[model samples]
Target: MTDCLFCRIIAGELPSKQRHSSDLVIAIEDIAPQAPLHLLILPREHIGSAADLRDTPAHAALLARMHAVAAELANEAGYGDRGWRLVSNVGVEG
Candidate 1:
């Protein structure tokens, strides 16, 4: 966990262009963004993989938080009333 790059980013040891932050989550622009509006959303904790999500039992709330954040982000980015799409790449590459 100490060596995890994301943990370092969350810890503020490594600089990140954070777009949004909350006590439980953080969102930042993807360094190698494939889309015009690409953001990497992750937990404030060191959740390295999807399996780690199970540890956080309040899954629906987490998703709700993500949706809220995404909507706000989209609006701020001028995605218009239709809003932007939110995708989570499981095992496949985007």
Candidate 2:
């Protein structure tokens, strides 16, 4: 976990310009955004990557909630109709 950058962010050891945070996750605007509107969403739990997910039922619901959160944010920013992309970084695929 010491090697995890997200863990450091959640711990406030690493400086991130955070946008929002809830009990489960934290949302931050990407420092070097790919799009005009880009956000980095991460969970508080230390899940290594997509391969780390074991398809647990709880994880399914959690992912759904995370997507919903992103959707809500996009809609609020008037980007829902403009369209957007949610990228979950999974190891080298990121």
Candidate 3:
């Protein structure tokens, strides 16, 4: 996982690090944003893929925190309750 792009970003080894990084997650604008408010909300901890996510309390908390950050971002962007989409890409196809 040392070679993972996200891991490097989280480790402060990459310049792509955004202003929204925290202990639990890093929220960056998508390099190729397809929407007006596109953002890539990634975990600071390196999880190999969505398939690698396990059903545990820690995992659940992390996931919840991710979504909460996203919602907060959306609301701050003036999209509160207006509807926004979150897309998750898993495995190779991502």
Best by lDDT: 3
Descending-TM-score candidate ranking: 3, 2, 1
**Candidate that beats the other on TM-score, 1 or 2, i.e. the better one:** 2
Q: Candidate 1 — which residues are off by over 4 angstroms?
A: 55-57, 92-94
Q: What is the Cα-based TM-score of model 3?
A: 0.89
Candidate numbers sorted by lDDT from highest down: 3, 2, 1
Residue by residue across 1-94, what tens digits does model 2's lDDT show? 4989889988999899887788778888887988987888888888888778778887887787788889988998899898988877778857
Tell how far residue 41 is off in model 2, in angstroms: 0.8
Model 2 C-alpha lDDT versus the unseen true structure:
0.83
What lDDT score belongs to each candidate, Candidate 1 first? Answer: 0.81, 0.83, 0.84
Q: What is the Cα-based lDDT of residue 76 in candidate 3?
A: 88
Over 1-94, each residue of candidate 1 has an lDDT whose tens digit, in order, gives 4898888888889888999999878999988998899998877767666655664558767877877888889899999586678887664453
lDDT of 1: 0.81
Q: After superposition, how far is residue 1 of candidate 1 from its true place, in Å?
A: 6.2
**Candidate 3, 1-94: lDDT as tens digits:** 4889877777767767364766799898877879999988999887888889999999998999899999989898888879998888988888
